[model samples]
Target: MADARAANERRVRRLEQMKTNGSAGAASGTLKAFWHGGRKPAHIVVRSALLKRVEGGNILTRLVLPRGVALRFYLLALFEAQCRLAVGGQWENVLPLSGPGSWSDMIASDGAYDGKSGTYMRGTRGGRAAEDLRLRQVQGALRTLEEVGGERPDQALVEVPRGPRGQRLYPSFRLLQESGRGSHQSPDIYTVPTDHWHPSRTVTIPAAFFLNGWVQVLSPSEVATWLALRVLSKWAPEKHQESGVFLYGDARKQQFGLRRDAWEDGCQRLLNFGLIRFARPMKDGDPAVPPTPNSWLMDFDQPEPRERYEPHRYQVIDEGLDQDAVRVCHRELTLRQHALDRRAAEVQSRKNGGPQQDVWPQWDGGEREMRFEEV
Candidate 1:
């Protein structure tokens, strides 16, 4: 159905799956990422529909993730779990809530557990405690998805609202029955997007910083922005990781549906945490008005390290001709504005939770008539 769904996801997964499960000829197909440096880091399948929902502007209405990184991290664990289940072809293994069966009894993931019946719940988090903490946020997201899918919640949609420890619960993703052969089938199945498996759509995310405590406090948007950067990194890992790049193309903002302020704030956070630095692309051989990008590069590991990436160095040339140049000019202007906003955010963050600055001087000039400040 629609080749399993979602354009970007279909190709990447298909190629990788083909390489892993293909015939002798297909098995010989070598991917640079798979063979380069060392064996490629294993990936968790993230459904294209779901990724679009998280990052797409229109697909997901009534934004469910209101606060910070909880939603992002929850999705991380959920999708990882889905990837394993799909790969193993062990769909619908979660124990039903019938007599003599419980969540602890099912085989959840690739590993073995003592008290837990299955590897499913724990597999979602890859058996890491820090990653597992994010799973607590999954329940609310599930509720939101039910609304999006146009499904009304019936008693069968979920089980006990809370676990034994009073933690909000989510239905085990193991419920997706690909065969549809169970005595009682769930109307909703874990979605496996129709995969043409575009090889180019594959993204490689290194489990380094987050695993090592580098980005524990990121917000949801920050997480999304970081991921977008990670996707970009796939194009040139050495350049992206070494230089820490920017969203240089003017149209990429609209293409990715990123709100200006959110992206800038996310960049600032990454910079402050010593993970990245920003600067303008080196302008060299050019036609006078050399096209350059005001961008950020990773500041932490490199031949030369620096404390901050220089900003506000862009000087727009209004004399340029042609429509394309005009668009580039506008993007620079927008980036200039972003610099100012980021500085403002840094000052506000120091004050804790963006406190309003009392710039009215308490009694500016003839304030008896009216005050410009919030009352």
Candidate 2:
């Protein structure tokens, strides 16, 4: 354990050095300029089809990165590349004027900034670390996209650029070029005009998500939850708009492959972020009104309500991102996490028979009966 701890400390020190030095160089200025360009696009288009479940299941499940940052970065890059393709850019070629620095900078500027350190955080490390972590994450995402084909040769969504000798190239990258290769290929392939509307095939992520630092403030699960909610809101059935989309069953949750805890936690965070609101009328304490057909309260008076489940009617709030809201959500989540930890500890203590007693019952002759006394 001592050796392991020492090694970890060494690694951290190196990362800190990288962070300090990288920020002081010309590369840093270039990154900032590239990301903060006045002419940069205002919104990013994500292919919803990528989120859809295929035979191999959700692509997110295969991602090596812990947070949703990798997924976000991959989608952003894909959008840019597709736009290029739509405008008659060459397929199966290196992205024009694109390299590791710009790629990593885009993601870091959006998701890796550390408010406390006043520098971009690296990887899953909360404190200072090397900007190369973002590059590695980008590579990992691309690798995952390429390897998602698994045993099926034609299922890969990307074909990473390689040298003539099949050696890996550090800077060059390319999406799958063949017109009809991957069975699970994203609908984002360049075929028609990029500006054409395809409501069912795409989801537009507001530029505010990046510009307002929402990525830095929210967790991976929370980010995924918000995106999933957006997709649902877009596809929700007509007339259900008043109450929002129903997300009650395990089947519904499984569609996105998000575990129950993660999904619930994400929903709670989104609620705290003021990005979403639940519309359960019955739980509002109005006794006169009848519960909706989907409400769990409909069986409230029953002795046993078959199975218990929280009925959710999620409404995605379309509003500008707020810094105050993000700060409040962070504070609320921290407090709630502490409370949950305390409750878990208490339960564990009870299960372990906390504070075993040393006293035992002893007979008292004077009392003429068995009496309890300290042993």
Candidate 3:
């Protein structure tokens, strides 16, 4: 049976490869049309096989995709990680249905309660507070994951805060679970709003599509490079263009936290990434300029480039390069244009107001004919 399944899978893979080639050819045709006319073709061509299986989402549900994918990947990834870290079966699975459903039992067993379970629910003695607190944290993480993922998630595990009068609150996340697990025993991928499911349909997403969507994976090398970029970006070419020494000196002083060795390491990482290029290297036996205090070049003319070592600047990398960077750059350009326009208008106004201040009234209007007194 396994051999038969494997053969079928191989056959499917071969057919999919052919389909991809056809799609590429069609895409090339579309691009050619766009290049010629600057518009997409009125009719888009799709393989019959693809057309047969596309189940489009509803407008509201479709809108959810952006958040959905982000939350799903990040939260699920984090949850999986935490689960792996946690002692197996030591921490109970508390369904988020009730604020403290299973956790309440965990707390109630701790003898942290007084009257019946109902009494603790009504009164606050800080009883079972830990359970409630964990729930709160999970709730916060869930909300963050949802926004980041750009999708409404399975809310079956969620419950909102208590009402003003203390009634059970409605769930912010609505759960959508389907019956039965797949062959791998995974929970068959629950989603919010039930319309997204269909059997025998292949689904795929681009690798790195969530590049800046979730947690920024920071490596030591990457962190170092970011620090370097931050410091280098702030360099005032106008101020230090003449000496270049002041630039390195200031960087060394201001970036006290990152030592000389660390800075050099960071710079090495940045160089590897190709984000910057060296302007010039000091040659042996050449007279060197003394570095200026508190300048970007305080330690330049060194054997190697050094890291920028500025924390404030490294935040540029922490945020990650994404649509946000593009938007910010665009906004800055727009503002700069506005400022330029305003300055131009002011200059035009001055020009129109008669520039007689700089000229001596045109040599008193009539003293132009100097014919050497007819001599």
Candidate 4:
């Protein structure tokens, strides 16, 4: 136990040294350059087919649409249909889907009025009409799934939970899994309620899939991130960090080579995604320190600011160059341009007979004799 404690202390000390030294090899060089230069780069924007139409519909509604439709347009249609069925002519009671804050407050509940299979909807134009319309939509969606996938369900009516505050009104359906897939390959569909559109309603179709012999429902963001990363993995940056940086310079002279810079780049990418935050260094000598390099121990599972996911927000620093070199070049250019501008301004002022401010005043550096009496 003592040996283990000593080893842990050594590791903590090493991390502190790396955090202070600011070496190029401290972490991944690619990530170091990215962090030092600027946090914004361009590659991180998510472009799932559903995300493309965020302005026209809420994220939940778009989840129900076919893969290619615009997210926003689908949402608008969903909301309109809900209004027509739930409370025709009562527009004031319906809500409007707006921002991320609204999305977070949404809930899904199973109400007594939750409909069953084969319920045809009828309504005029407001919240009640909207409720019935959404129910029909849910059934329609289920039927379409049958037509496309050709998987028949064992049951006629599956009761799905109503959305937050009583918005959703759809019966769910299930399709049998094909050969070679997991036992629960067929997932039951359910409607997710949201407060985005307010009193009227918006419902989402969610699928519960299996992983590791356990059933799990993937959120929209989770699914998008998985697919996006898969797409991005093919185009990973040319350079990555080597493992040696974590070992400190003790291994620098060793024959084995490690590209520690790559790890830093990964860190920067994660930071750009808002998955991790860079903590301001605390000078106090606390023995129980956090991991300094890569810092993978952070609470990365939490929701990050959506903007960080854009890959383009991180600047790519060429592995061969130093950040100081770029800053020097920029300063030199600015000085030269300022001198030229000053000269041009003086010339322009002379030509136009405009009020001019003298950039340089006459100067006499030599000592002068006391000859004021003669003058």
Ranking by TM-score: 2, 1, 3, 4
What's model 1's TM-score?
0.40
Worst 10 residues of 1 by lDDT: 366-375
- 1-375 per-residue lDDT for model 3 (tens digits): 234234333323323332332322232232233223422222211111111111231111111221112223222322222222222212122234234222111111111223454222332233345445434544553444333213423311222346789754434332212211223422233331211122112111111112221112222333433433433333433322332211233434343223354445344333322333343443344334333433323333656543433121121222233333222322333333343344455556688993433322243221121111000
At residue 220, what lDDT does model 3 achieve? Answer: 31
* Candidate 2 Cα errors over 4 Å, as ranges: 1-42, 64-69, 78-101, 109-129, 176-199, 216-220, 237-241, 248-255, 280-310, 324-329, 348-375
Q: Tens digit of lDDT per residue, candidate 4, span 116-235? A: 642222331223443333344444543433332123232211222366786534322222111111225344322222223211122122110110100011222323332222222222
Q: How many pairs collide in each candidate, listed in order?
A: 24, 0, 30, 58
Candidate 1: count the clashes: 24
Model 3 local distance difference test score: 0.29
Quickly count the clashes in candidate 4. Answer: 58
Angstrom error of the Cα, residue 195, model 4: value is 30
lDDT value, residue 222 of candidate 4: 29
Better of 2 and 4 by lDDT: 2
TM-score of each: 0.40, 0.60, 0.21, 0.19
lDDT of 2 at 195: 31
Off by over 4 Å in 4: 1-125, 148-172, 175-375
For candidate 1, write residues 52-81 as lDDT tens digits.
322223222223254323243333333333
Ordering by lDDT? 2, 1, 3, 4
Q: Which candidate is the best by lDDT?
A: 2
The sequence of per-residue lDDT tens digits that candidate 2 reaches over residues 1-375 is: 234234333323433433444432323344235445433544555655555555665555444245435555554554445434443444443333234446655544232455588654555443233445556666766666667657754656556668899976745555543221355544324232233254346666665565454554455666777777776666643423566654534333346656666666567657656677776453443222222333211222444333433356678765736443334443554444444444455666777989533222332111111111110
